[model samples]
Target: MRFLAFLLFIAFVLFAIFARWFFICDILNLCEEAPVEVEVAPRLQTLQLTENDSVLLSGYDQFAFSKGIDQPELNTNNEQFLDTLAQMLTADTTKSLEITGRFTPQEKDIMAGFYENMGLARAAAIRDLMASRGIDENRISLKHAITSDSLLQEPLLFAFALNDLPSEYATASYRFTNMTYSDANFPSNSAIFDPGEAFRNYADSVKVYMEAHPEKSIRIVGHTDNIDSEKYNLKLGMRRAESAKEYLENLGITSAIETESKGETEHVASNDTPEGRQENRRVNFIIE
Candidate 1:
């Protein structure tokens, strides 16, 4: 009887230990940090303008915005950086909008705070900057802003891109919304090829068109099919744009030619079929 009792006691002790260990592990996991989302405030869309076909801006250079950081203020390189930003906003005329420059993923380390708070700082700074410019709080926009390295390709929030700028305006305004300079694919751009004969004609036509009208700026947009990754599409987009730019440059209409790419992000055709993919891989030229 005593031996059976001893055996029962041992079994009970083992079960208790196992139960304690399991619960402890579960508790640890529960204590882990949850995934965080960076939320930006509603942006200002009213003040934006599109001059001609592609370029976007605020009606003037006086306005600016700050980019986002993953971890709130934790990565602040130095307290002086914040002070410098504040000073730039305050002493407007002396500094040419200290564009906190884009976040170029340099090896420079940033102190971590909270990720959400970091984004908040960026938003707050932009608002403060605009308010200082004598612009009403309602007129400023931070919705189009981003902390990524490339402004041209950030598929952020419901923000409108430079494409939303009005094409009818002779000279539109765009503010320095944010910077994403470190993104290897910067603008995640892409392009479609107008190879062979059509390519030559497109090139030649642009040359003639620009030669006839010297006062306008030409915007070359390259698009890519959804057949590949966003990064690959972006490269293809650049190639398409460069092909167009080189074509126009060769024609000697050198004054205002800008190139951009919209890899898979901006697709005109369905990605499911071969024909649609082929159609998606082309470039567009917007002239103003």
Candidate 2:
């Protein structure tokens, strides 16, 4: 009996030790685990603008923007860089500037009243700002790209190349309002469209319009470039229209939806260039 009592006491002591350790470490927060390392995103250290294989503006702070916004937030360094660039362009008469603005798929086309996409809006905004800074608006060309970087803080990417010089002045207004509607663009020979923030905003606007006109119905017409046979293109266009209809239905639009296909027939732009073809492959929303 004595031996058993001693064994019980030993077990109790061990349990007490473990219980105290657990109470201190787990309950009282006195212990720490291994520190976790976080991965940081790489940022651009320099802002560069080149022309005809030569660097014009270099070693400036990268231009950044607020998340989901098109307006660039310029710091003192950025302003200085711009002032220097304006002076350089004034001195050099042969060189021209091209501003290519970038936008992620998540950004909305808030400047739909002026530009077709957020990327174009951003580029135009920069061009107008430069114009106000005494840079010749005729010497600057605006372009846009759908950026691949999901975590990109700076949405403007700059590069230079030779292009035909024009004498017209830039004429884009700075005011912006939320996009009420936008065309859903598709990739080459693809029917699926990315229902981005612009699409969501358009759906919301449609919902409002639909509530006011309950008897009105919605129509989605899909168009395609001249790529394949007429029959095949028609079928592809129909698929594209159906895809848009599905997106609208998922976005809580209860109005009657109609789908049509105008394959390679009605195009807003010439189908000669790749950019034109991309623009041609789109689905337009119409209220009927």
Worst 10 residues of 1 by lDDT: 172-181
lDDT of each: 0.45, 0.69
Report the error of model 1 at residue 245, Å: 0.8
C-alpha RMSD for every candidate = 18.9, 10.6
**Which candidate gets the maximum lDDT versus the true structure?**
2
| Collision pairs in model 2 | none
**Number of colliding residue pairs in model 1:** 29
Model 1's lDDT to the true fold? 0.45
Residue 46 displacement (Å), model 1:
47
Task: Give the candidate number with the greatest TM-score.
Answer: 2
Each candidate's clash count: 29, 0
RMSD of 1: 18.9
